[model samples]
Structures are given as structure tokens and as C-alpha cells.
Target: MPRPLPDDLLKLPHRRDVPFAKLTTLGVGGTCRWLFEPTTEGEVQSFVRACVREGLPYKVLGGGSNLVVLDDIEIPVLRLALPKEVIREGTRLSAPASYGHIRLSQDAAKAGLAGLEFAAGIPGTTGGALRMNAGAYGRELVDVLQTFRFLTPEGELVEKRPEPGEFRYRWSFLTGGHVALGYTVALAEGDAEAIAATVAVNMEKRGTSQPLSKRNAGCIFKNPTGSSAGRLIDQAGLKGFRIGDAEVSPEHANFLVNHGHATAAEFAELMATVREKVRAVHGVELEPEVEIWR
Candidate 1:
């Protein structure tokens, strides 16, 4: 039997047997046993503290845009329901980790901020973006990150600036029990109209080059060295390949899409086949960019 949760954690808004297919962008997976949604920082802090004190492990879920859940998760899961609020102090902008990543960019543009244009086309939430050091169009979360607050493995809150070797290409030091609470971005003042225009261009680029019409968990594989992952997969003649309902996106080879009625197992198998084919044809190993939850 599983250990009982503290009253504080149990009191928070939650549901049982929530489907990952409904929670995640991929729209497939088994159910989450316990789904806790804390709407305030204090509640989140309490949740983290309770987990630590009870010797319980938990998973933090953001927008679920970059995750692949393979099976029903029996452990407790926390997905922040904090109010969507953005605070601005001159060039610095602060937002809850639960805030939408793409909406945050739009908010910045509305406030005449320039540095967040790279995030215009990014999916997921700010916390996941920070955890993965998510980047696009030559800029990353680290470039504009000023400071962030996260709970340590012991449930102690810590706030600090980006440190050396802490962030890298599509990766960060925020693994394990660390849970990002909120973060601030250091942006530049620019014409609001121009900022919006830049965002539009980025969004348009994504629509053109990506299979936004189908269900996808963003990029399936990370770029290798100097070359692009999509280009390599396309050159390997793996585009439009399918296994069950999972298919290598014809528009973008690095993306695997679900044409509805797809299962997580099929998606996993399709990815494996694509990787094997890419390796055989290009002699390059592809690393997954999306997180796989088992």
C-alpha cells in the first residue's frame, strides 16, 4: 500500500485517475493516479514540503508539450494552477512557472519587450522551458533568464541567477526533486508593433515548417552537432513513415505526429524505427528531445 499524504496535500484541489491523454499534448497515455493542482505559491510550497517530510516522490507536470507518457503513473503528480499573472519591473518581467510559454512571449511583446521573441513559437509552460533550457531561432531561455525560484530536494526554496555549466543546449541542472516555482526574464525595450511583428513572423515560420495541424509532442529528436535533426531524417528518406497511427511528419521529419487514435506504444515503436533508419542511412545517432514518462 502507498503511504498516506498529509492533510495539507490532500486538501489541495485534485482529482483521481486523470488521463494523461487529456493532460498531455500527445493526447495518449494511461491515467495519472493522483493529480494535484496547487493554485498558489504557498500551496505549492506546502505540497513540496509535505512530499519531503513523508518521504514521497512526486512528478511536476507543466504544459505537457514535450512529454511522452508510456504507462499509467501510480505516483502523485503536481501540475501548478497558479493564477496567470505577469509582473513587470522596468526591463525585468516575472511570471509564475505555470504561465503559458507562448503567451508569455505575447505578453512581453504587448509590453514592448524584445528579448523574448525567440519564445514566440515555443510550446509548454515557463517552468518546463527553464528546466530544459528550451530555445529556438538562435536564442534560449538562459540568454534572457535573470533569476528563478525552485524548491530543493529537501523542500527548501532557493533563488539564484544562471550559474556556470548549469544550462546547456536543450538541457539544465533542474532534474531530480527540484521544482521550479517562478522565474524572471530580463528583456529589452522595443517598439511594441515591431515586437508583435517579429512574433508573427516566428509563428508563421513554425506553421509553415512544422506539422501544426496534427498532434505532436514538439521535436522528437535533438539536433546533432552542426546539422539539423529534421534535415538528417529527411535526407535519410524516413519522412511520411508510419507505424500504426504514429507517423514521421511529412512537413518536418524530426517531428512524429499522431493522426488520431494512436497509442503511446505505437509512437514509441515509430520513434525507434526512425532512429534505426537514420542511423543506418546517415551514420548518426539521434537523441530524443522529448521527455519519456514511464
Candidate 2:
């Protein structure tokens, strides 16, 4: 049974019974019983403080690009709705956690910033990218990250440069009760035309290799050491595989696409089967890159 929510939390702007199908990129799963959207940092702090006081556990949701909800989540979920303002100081740019990731990359390119070209095609919020240390084309967010702001589990605010061991391949320390507020990236001044050209090339690569027309939660598994997850799945001959509406994309084996009306259960089964067959044939245990929530 779920515990009653605190009165303080109920006072925040929220929605009820929002379907996860509408919330995630995979477009599958049950409902999110309580979805809190805080329009300001103060409201986010208040929500965190209220949950802490009541000993309640909550989850922070970003752009929902890298998530797969398995069922109805009764606990309160926090999604930032901060003002979309990007602060530029010389070659540095900063934005709230709620700002769109792709939009930020475009903004940087327009400003003649060179470092974010690799992020031009990455989807999700800037905070979510920071949380996952998102990368592409052999570069990562940490490579350009200057500083970041986050709320501690105790609801205290802290802003500082990233430390060693705090971030790694598709992972970060901003888990458990921690919540990212914003981030600053140090970029280099470059020719706007050149920056735009690089960004365009990256986008074109993604357009050709990825299944952008289909609904998917990006890559289903992380690439194992010295091997590509997509290549491995392709070599294992799982491409075009299907169970229900969930299918391993023939275009990119690492991506699992939902052909509308896919169920969470079907996706789960498909993932398990892919893993089993890959391991049986290749002897490599694949790890999931997307965050799974129930």
C-alpha cells in the first residue's frame, strides 16, 4: 500500500493519473499517479524539503527521452518547469535544468560556440544530459562542462565544478535524492558557419543511422567494452525481431521501436530475449542504458 502524501506536497502545481505512454519516448507503460511540475527553483526546493520532512521517496523526471516506465508510479514525481533563459558570458553558456538539450546545442552553434556540436542531436533536457554525461562522436558533456548546480538530498543547494569520479560513461552522481538545477559549459569561439556545418553533419549522421521516425528510448543497451551493442545485436541476427508491437529496429539493432500500441510488458520481454540470445551466442552480458521506472 502507498503512504498518504504530505499536505505541503499537495499544494504544489501537479497533475494526476498522467499516462506514462504520453510521458516517455518509448510510448508505453502505465500511469504516473502524481506529477509535480515546479516552475521555479524555490518551488523545487520546497518540494524536495517537503518530501524529506515526510520521509517520502520521490523521483525526478527530465525530458523522458531515456526512460521506460513499467507500471503506475504512486509516488510523487518531480519535473522541472523553470524559465527557459540561457545565460551567455563570453564563451560560456548556462541554462536551467528544464531547458531542452537539442535547443541548447543549436543556441551554442548560433553563438559560434564550438564545443557543443556533438550534442546537437542528443535529445532530452540539459540536466538529463548532465545526469547521464551524454556524449556523441567521441565527445561528452563532461568535456565541456564547467560547473553545475544541484539540490542535495537534504534540500540544500550547491554549485561547483565537476570533480573526478563524479561522472562516468552514461552515469553521474546525481542519483538517489539529488536533483540537478542547471549547468554551465565552457565553449570556444569558432566560425558560426563552421559550427553549423559540424552540427549539420552530426544531425545528418543520426538521420541516416537512427530510426527517428519510430518511437524509441534511444539505444536499449550500452556498448560493451571493445564492441558496439548495435553491431553485436546485428551480428547475432536479431534485427527486425518483434514481440507484439515492440521490435528491434532493422535499421539499428540497438534501438527498440514501438509501432504504436506497444505494451510495457512486450518491450520488457523483447529486451530479455535480445539479451539472452546475444549472451548465448556472443558470451557478452549487455547492460541497459535507459533508466527503467516502475
Against the reference, the lDDT scores of all candidates come to 0.90, 0.94
**Candidates' TM-scores?**
0.96, 0.98
Question: Which candidate gets the maximum lDDT versus the true structure?
Answer: 2
Model 2 lDDT on a 0 to 1 scale: 0.94
- Model 1, residue 172: distance off in Å is 1.4
Off by over 4 Å in 2: none
Candidate 2 local lDDT, 40-135, one digit each (tens) = 999999999999999899999998999988889999999999999999999999999999999999999999988999999899999899999999
Q: What is the lDDT of residue 8 in candidate 2?
A: 84
Q: Which candidate has the top score in TM-score? A: 2
Clashing pairs in 1: none
Error of 1 at 281 (Å): 2.0
Please list all clashing residue pairs in model 2, or write none if there are none: none
- Backbone collision count in every prediction? 0, 0
